[model samples]
Target: MVRFVDVPRMRHWVEERGVETVIRGIAERIESDFRRWPEFDTQARVASHSPGGVVELMPVSDSRRYSFKFVNGHPGNPAAGLQTVTAFGVLADVASGYPVLWSEMTILTALRTAATSALIARTLARPDSQVMALIGTGSQAEFQALAFRALLGIDSVRIWDTDPRAMDTFERNMRPLGFSVHRASDGAEACDGADIVTTCTADKAYATVLTDDMVRPGMHVNAIGGDCPGKTELEAAILHRADVFVEYPEQTRIEGEIQQLPEDFPVTELWRVLRGEEPGRTSAEQITVFDSVGFAIEDYSALCYLDSDLGEGEAADVDLIAEPADPKDLFALVAAGANSTVRLG
Candidate 1:
């Protein structure tokens, strides 16, 4: 039997412990994993793109367990009364090759994404950074605000988006949580006076949401929206002027803002900084860019974090795997159960 943390159960679990606790916990996990990044198998995620959107499978594993997340990104989903991003993931034992835990990842993705950004910002951003410019106020905007507050002591957020209603939703959601929210007239306005600039827009185009002028010295830019081919948020000049860091250089080259740069352009893998193998922010005036194109290892870490929290509250067991009485005679178990259950109506 596979233990399951379905959508409703996952929501209840977060509510029981509170989202801030979950964010802080997952941030710790991400930091720990990044420190020992070479111990796990890593790869760029495989994606299938269509006219509608893109579907992706992100897989990563350590020696003991393997995990994968199935997710899709469709910017038009909100107009269709659906989420722009939805996901579910499975964690399996490597030796047995059998799934152990399965969980809904739509909400978990938001949490992990925010946790990841915060974790990286903790290392790259200046210690005195207190304000964040949220350039996209979609499903991810509020979480990013919360994560910065929980992890980095950021209390003020200057926000903007093409949709007024989305900005309204973001302000309504974030203000109650203690953030001093300010609505900006445009992306440049939002970036003004912000210590950290986060661009998480969802348009599948190479749009310059943040130009070089918008980025100031000593600022860390968390670019999370340009996560696929032809999708980018920052102006290429911004990346040229910043000391760039990434989760995986290969993946980021294809799906992150770094794609706009020359193939040989310098980049430091974020793990190196986490491991103290490389410098994060070399000076108080240095600009740093975390070209965040969500990686598979993050999903792996999130699943591990969720799996460890099992039995803390109500969790459901799902018969997702077949348990054959005789491991060698898998056909026999299926034959035995096929009688009344397979009756022709």
Candidate 2:
């Protein structure tokens, strides 16, 4: 039997533990895994793109366990009354080659993504930063706000979106949670006087949601939306001015905001900074940008974190794998079931 955290159970888990606590826990796990970055197998996610959007398979493994997430990004889904992004993931035991845990990663991905952003901000953003400018108020906006609040003590947010309904949703969701939510007229208005700027728009094109003029010195830009080949959020001039940090350069060069720049453009892998092999923010006046294009290792960490938090009977057990009496007698097991009813055409 394999442990499965279906959508309902996952929601229950989040509600019981509280969203901020779960984000903080996942952040701790992500930080711990990043510190031992050299130990895991890493690579770019395999993606299939179409005019509509993209579907991706992100896989990674440590010596003990392996994990992968099946995810999709379709910007047009919302108009059709579907989620723009959705996912599920699995963690398997390396030795047995059997899946130990399976989870609905739609919620887990949001939590982990927010955790990752906050984790990077802790190192890259200035220590005294308080206010955050959220440029996109989609499904991810609230999670990002909560994660920053939990990790960085940021309770004030200035928000904007091309669609006023999105901004209204953000205000409706965040205001009751004790966050000081201010709806801005535009991206620049949202970014004005803010310490940290997070852009998470879902358009699958080269839209400059954040211009160069809006970004000031000492600001940390968490660009999480520009996560595909043709998708980007910030202007190229901003990349030139800031010190860009990424999860995996090979992947980021193909899918992140840095894709707008040349191949030879410089970037620092976030693991290096987390491992103390490279410097993070050197001065308060420096601009730091985390070009997060979500990686497989983060899913690995989230799966591990979820697995660790499971108590006895907390999750459902599903018989997901076939077990024969003898490992090499798989045919015999099938033959035993041959007597079962079957309808043939």
Candidate 3:
């Protein structure tokens, strides 16, 4: 039977390990995978865009296991009484494609995103960096805030967003954590004197949320939200003057900050830094950018965590789909569908 874990149970599992621990574990998995990165089957992703936003499916596996996630991003969803994003995923046996687990991925997605941010900050951000400027204050804001505060020693935060209600939502969710959260009126005010700047806006355009005039040396940017083709958050000028890092090259070139740059522009993959094959910061004054496009391997890392840590929870016995028991008995499953299986009479 496939075990299903809900968000409440997922939250329990996540809280038990804590942010820093989860991030470190993810880093270890990423490093291990990257050491032999060629071993696994990889695909960029498939996306469906509607009037609201976008929906995506990312699938990958080694020879042993398979997993895929169904996630949708609808910027106009909240107004329609739905989460901007809703997701679910499955873990399956690659040998037969039999699903081993079915799990809710909405909360897990948030956790994974936060863990990825923390991992990047640990690898690329300064040691003493404590303050962060969060550009978007929507569903992802609180998760990013909590992850940074827990992992990167970032105790103070300055937040800004186009949505006042989102800022309010962010503040309300994080106030109990006792971090010094400040709401800034504009992007410049939020970034003033901040060590790290995170751009997580939902706009799917090439809007320059952070300009050269607002940027200063020694700043590390966690550029989220600009994961699609037409979406970008940073000014093009910043890329010329900054050292940019990414998770995966082929995918991020079309998704991350380098999407604005030429085909041959220089960028560093985070794994190289983890493996000591590349330099992180050559100078203390050099601005750094982690152009985050939310890679699937990070999701793989997250699913690994959930599998090990998520204890017993509510499970629904749902027959999502099935095949015949016999390897060559494809006709039997359909013939047996809604018919007698056992002979008791």
Best by TM-score: 2
Q: TM-scores, in order shown? A: 0.96, 0.97, 0.89
The digit string of per-residue lDDT tens for model 1 on 1-345 reads 888998899999889878888999889998999888999998889899999899999999999999999999998898899998999999999999999899999999999999999999999999999899999899998888888888998989999999999999998888888889999999889989999999999999999999999999999999999999999999999888899999999899999998888899999999999999999998989999999999988888888998997664467888887778887877886685566566677
Model 1 segments more than 4 A misplaced = 336-345
Candidates in descending TM-score order: 2, 1, 3
In terms of lDDT, which candidate is stronger, 1 or 2? 2
lDDT of each: 0.91, 0.95, 0.81
- Candidate 2 shows a clash count of 0
Name the candidate, 2 or 3, with the larger TM-score value: 2
The residue pairs found clashing in candidate 3 are: none
lDDT by residue (tens digit), candidate 3, 100-158:
77789998788778778877787778777889999999888888887787677687889
C-alpha RMSD by candidate, in order: 2.5, 1.9, 4.1
> Per-residue lDDT tens digits of candidate 2, residues 195-308?
999999999999999999999999999999999999999999999999999999999999999999999899999999998999999999999999999999999999999999
Q: Give the C-alpha miss distance for residue 310 in model 2, angstroms.
A: 1.0
TM-score of 3: 0.89
